[model samples]
Target: MTPRPGVREYVRLIALGRPPVGWRTTDVTTWSLARLAGRLIDRLVVPRMSRGTLRRILREGKVS
Candidate 1:
């Protein structure tokens, strides 16, 4: 089955940081600093995320 997103999936959007131009995800109604933080915490419990890693992923992230 497709791993669909729920209230929990918004966190991946955090992994997204500032939304990578053409990037998109599921289960979203708005954008707010507080909301982003909440979603990141609500869904995927990313223990530690670094700016450098985020930057690298932005550079090397796979595309279809």
Candidate 2:
């Protein structure tokens, strides 16, 4: 999207969004290393993103 001029303009910027979910089956306090920016970007339905590009987006958005 390259909407970094002010990414917060593209979508409602949730600087820190929800975290990943985990299911230990025996515990619910376990979380993975999922540093996935916590909703830095919305998971679009029309197109999917590649890790590399997402990284670039993060770099451009200065959210990295």
Candidate 3:
């Protein structure tokens, strides 16, 4: 199955440290500092995640 669009775009944008032209933001949802921080945590702190596991965490992270 294909990956979630935003999540895949997010990973690429982060790896590049800037969004490509096609990834331009709109009025409804602009990328922000907090979002970058969250992505960093997702990439660095979260364990290697399969699509199913990632979706689970996206829904509710490590509930304890």
TM-scores, one per candidate: 0.31, 0.38, 0.27
Provide the lowest-lDDT 10-residue window in model 2. 30-39
Candidate 3's TM-score: 0.27
TM-score-sorted candidate list, best first: 2, 1, 3
Q: State in Å the error of residue 50, model 2.
A: 0.3
Where in model 2 is the C-alpha error above 4 Å? 1-15, 20-46
Judged by whole-model lDDT over C-alpha atoms, candidate 2 comes out at 0.39
Question: Per-residue lDDT for 29 in model 3?
Answer: 42
Question: Which residue pairs collide in model 3, if any?
Answer: none
User: RMSD per prediction, one decimal?
Assistant: 10.5, 6.3, 11.1
Q: Encode model 3's per-residue lDDT on 1-64: one tens digit a residue.
A: 3345565454444544543344433432433444534554555743343545444434342221
lDDT of 2 by residue, 11-36 (tens): 22332333445422233342222333
Error of 1 at 42 (Å): 5.0
What C-alpha lDDT does candidate 3 achieve relative to the native structure?
Answer: 0.44
In order, candidate lDDTs are 0.41, 0.39, 0.44
Q: Best candidate, lDDT-wise?
A: 3
Q: Could you tell me the lDDT of residue 56 within candidate 2?
A: 63
Tens-place lDDT digits, model 1, residues 1-64: 1122442243444545553343243545444444444444444654443444434433343310
